[model samples]
Target: MLTSPVDDEPPLTGKMQPTNVVVLGASGSIGEASLDVLSHLPPKRWQAWGVSAHRQLGELSQRLFATGLRPRFIVASDPDSASMAQGMPWPKGSELLFGGDALVDLATHPQCDTLIAAIVGRAGLESTLAAVQAGKRVGLANKEALVVGGCLVCEARQVSGAELIPVDSEHSAIFQCIQGSSSPPRSLILTASGGPFRTSTGEQMRQASVADALAHPTWQMGRKISIDSATMMNKALEIIEARWLFDVPPSKIQVMIHPQSVIHSMVEFVDGSVLAQLSPPDMRLPVQYAITYPERLECPVSRLDTLSRYDWEMLPADPERFPALTLGFEVAAAGGTAGAVLNAANEAAVQLFLDGEIRFTEIVPACRSALENHHFEQHPTLQRLLEVDRWARAEVQRWHSGTRA
Candidate 1:
């Protein structure tokens, strides 16, 4: 009948193909949401090429069996060094890789077209670099990769022609706003939820418990990230991430306190026009965008209703109140070994604080001490970075324990 639409279309049965993808940190919040999105994608749109987790073999196995999508490779970043004869296990046809080097190797695997860098903290740095060096389209959820080695990451991206797409909601919003603009914007305005302690005074923060800190008002996230939000350390780290991702200076990136988290981020053009992306506070929306770059795929997350009257406010972040914010910008501007040390120190301190070993205020102080004591090494090679990361961890532990002793 009138040359049917199906007849006119090319045969998709054998033609259209999905990109091969890897999900690093596949057991985390972002990873879970990513899997949800991947499960929904059309067969011709995307495929899960590999999956990785730190140490969740049972959970990982169940997830793989449920999806019926066995990756060619699965990585367990944690391994028992004492049992050298133990075999890494996965689905019958899949291979299991172990340890940090295995993570890097899997990231740069020849079949990987896109890498979802969701591994948290500084542990993500090497794998992220490996992905970049291999010229894979990187869905960068790992902020520490940029935080600890922004210059190196930026350089790698340039050298290998890898595209770094932002997966964080704030960064994702700014990314969308920048896409339509004629040129680079005058400033990138990242929105902060002010966390659960937005209204709490500095004295209140001192008395804040882990339970208080973890009770995020808007978004669901991991323990470490929740604590980062409480101290506004998340915003601080985003400052560094935005610096490298956008190739903008810390001065050009601004943070606004938006307690509702309705407006993820905004971009101010040179002519005074501000473009912002507003959506419901959901990680899936941003995760979807990262997965399908240059294409706006359909997702379940909702958009803000512009017709309704909504209150939105912007305020300067007080660095004195949240020293974590200052330390973030300081490390970003300092460059070299500072990011490695700051990240490692904060990771240790955050864990200690979570364990109720230190006061909330001590988090920033411990990080500051670590940064100060760090031996400056210019042009840090990968080996040097690893050394500094280990050194910072030891130093933070020593200080934390000595203070208690």
Candidate 2:
């Protein structure tokens, strides 16, 4: 369980002043869910102070208009997108900023009481770190930040007293189950939906197309994430994240295949009891919880139909089918340059697969090759980690091109 003292703070309630939130990667799926969650919340209790989009200025504008949120800051992280934003119908009283540096600026801004880090891939790391260093309550959806640089983020949290609340449904479920516990949990159990290829044979996955990989059974996510899910690398990254988030060893963390996606996650006690959080597979529930933690609010998501008959299934994940799970455990235990290399290599390989350069089955092998080839550093600075990330991506490219010895 999390040992941070920041959890003791009073929950954000209606009686308190409106909490200003900055949603980074406001163009992505998680960001869209966050906007919906904010829109449904009482306006007097919460405000969208800032929002950012990398290349989807149009989509971001549409979301802003639909939600009727006039955030104080609108950031266009891509230069090309910022150039076209000169004539966009931005909300009045909103200051428009350009470039990636502005994201870090808004994250550490004084008015930012909370920041929702939803940016995908390694692009979200700097701003997410900036928010934690500035002592803001962070709703962390960008698991890559913790996967690549968990040590730095955890260390900064200790120094700045930031509250790192999870927005991922699985981690959020684990956080909820461990609350007010009398003793430390014996193990943390994370559940997976097994992606679209769960029931398919190994040969089917080897021949899977981009469309097949993106067809997630239970969740609607962006392209990169959908590919990760298909390969079970998303769960692998989450394993690395859980190791740092809860301050637990990799040996104490476990993953189970739950096709229903109802039981998000579980916590096992020392006395042989398990506490699980079951909810409909809705991201809004966890997003709302991260925003108004320790205080449950009426969410807009539909409730589970307890009156109807339902079947739930839990099975052991097959290591033979999902090789990425082994890589996840290896990175979680190795803890340094290994994570940066695995994440970058996986990202590059996924992109290669999507672009028709490699087979879906080649992704995990590429990640493993990069992880084994990278120099093992027990303790690495942020700069060193970034260097490893770049090196791993290049290595994957070289490996695909048959240039590496």
Name the top TM-score candidate. 2
Off by over 4 Å in 2: 1-16, 403-405
Q: Cα lDDT of model 1 overall?
A: 0.84
Residue 43, model 1: lDDT of 56
Tell me the spans in candidate 1 whose CA falls farther than 4 Å from its real position: 1-15, 65-68, 81-93, 305-308
C-alpha lDDT of all candidate models, in order: 0.84, 0.92
lDDT of 1 by residue, 78-163 (tens): 87631331343456667666677777776786667799999999989988998999899999999998888888899999999999
Q: What's the TM for model 2?
A: 0.95
Looking at candidate 2, the ten consecutive residues that score lowest on lDDT are: 1-10
Please give the lDDT score at residue 55 for candidate 2. Answer: 92
Q: What TM-score do all the candidates reach, one by one?
A: 0.91, 0.95
